[model samples]
Target: MSYQDPAIHRYGQVIGLTIAAFVAADLLWLPFSNITVDSSNGVAVIIAGLIAGGYWLAGAVCSRMARRSRLSKVWGAIAAAFENIAIFLLAFIPMSVASCLFMYLASSTARPRLDAYLVDADKALGFDWPSALAYANSFPMAAAVLVFCYAALTWQIPIVVLWHACVNGRRRLLEFCAVLFASSVLTAITMAAVPVDGPYLYFKPAASLYDHFTNAGLSHATTVEALRSGPFIFLISKTVGITCFPSFHTTLGIVITYALRRTPFFFPVAIVNALMIVSTVPEGGHYLVDVIAGGLVAVAAIVGVRRLADHGRRIRTALLPSE
Candidate 1:
């Protein structure tokens, strides 16, 4: 019997529930809160719908091709893998935008600041972020290299998704997407409980030492300004990064590394991801505790996703009624 991939449907169910919760929360909060709906958010929703439609269309085409030829199983599976990639990408875009909006909304609800506590926790652990930043900045070349790796997060997701889809197969690709979904959800939880602006803003003066390393237009200044204005809109132009406490960058590094494990790309990917995680401190202006939290979140997400997949399979088997 062909092994059933539960990750596919499991992904859909989880995503649907997540989006529903966010929409409900947004509606409930809109009346009493200072937050206002922006047209950009609507644009984001429409774009997400388009992407999802394309994903389904691709899957339909792939399925038709697969069933039409007896000797094309390999190619058919490959096409199906691309379909899987589409589903994942479609899921990722909306999930990311939703999570960002969720985090910002949560931040707006909280009146007190949490950055000082997080900074203190870092200091208590003997992780001096300032000294670390200074040391990193001392080496311009190294700092530049790390910054490049840090920026890789933007393109890494699609590239890794494509790589897994084309090379591994549907099951593995689904597994990766499942873990990502879990991580993104966990990120919202952690950020809401303790919203922070990261080390750059918390340590603005000290961070300015490395101002030369930062991109010209982007800096802590812009983030601070946007954040002070109000809650982030889904597709708001130049919306600031509101997540802190746990570094999503660190979480991403762990997830990617975990996804690539047991493959020929493991060692190389490991090194790159390791750099990416470490670079989070300086490049991302994240506190040490934040990075630790992100790593833990990644671990939990992987374990949780696996158990979910296993439970889904067991339930499916039980319902199969006598072989």
Candidate 2:
């Protein structure tokens, strides 16, 4: 395998190991906690796995056909996409599972919230979260529009990763996946340590233009109970939890923008993603500091991934015999 191949494979290995650890933790916590595993998420995971596996199987067939028949660019392109199917799936599913697992573990522990500190920081930075929220609530139509744009995050990540993995080269896909996973790890750790519920829950903004609390479709009481109990189920239909330290949504917005930065739609992508980030304040229940931390994480991931890639290339080149 090439240097990059091992690096890419390591992502899968790490996520798989982390998943195992989560399972182990769940089992260990079963004695003391009341959380029960909801099989729905497991079903979702299985379905996703099967779909990704199907892509790989189809890609392999196309790749073999391309190699055997007359050289054709169209077929080759198709085959290239199939070959990267594994990269897309491996990058996505496992990372997602690990995130959900870690989130459950952290929240269940019931660590003291850092909302007061985040609020103080926001005030110090001259960012009035409540005023910002009131402004958002003032324009119902605008808030609605922002909410829709922000909600795009659910599909945006998978679509972008799949599109790039198929159309772009493996290196870009690998780097993007690596960065996402790394950023997730950072966000999870920060959340576990500083566990804040965000401005929405903190301030209890009146239910008017923004009814995010209801719109979220989650019962805060049930969610808290699940966190404190055993089985620690990751629900498929309701993935949102009480995560608010460094805003993962804001981080995702920056990452998505970064992913599409070099494309022809850079300006439009930037504008839309900027709105997504801005929307996090009211719609996502995020503090301003959360957004800032998320952006910093994005920058770090981007830079770190590139540096690792370069270092891998150097090591690989050095090991090769001189001409």
lDDT of each residue in 62-168, candidate 2, tens digit only: 87777887866667778777667665785567566656766766777756777899999999999998788778778778877788777777877666666765674
In the predicted model 2, the residue pairs found to clash are 33-230, 34-229, 34-230, 35-229, 35-230, 108-227
Scored by lDDT, the top model is: 1
lDDT of 1: 0.72
For candidate 2, what is the total of clashing residue pairs?
6
> What does candidate 1's lDDT look like per residue over 30-90, in tens digits?
5665556578767866777787678668767777877887756775766666577676767
Query: What lDDT does candidate 1 reach at residue 83?
Result: 72
Alpha-carbon RMSD of each model: 3.2, 3.4
Error of 2 at 116 (Å): 1.2
Q: Which pairs clash in model 1?
A: none
Per-candidate total of colliding backbone pairs: 0, 6
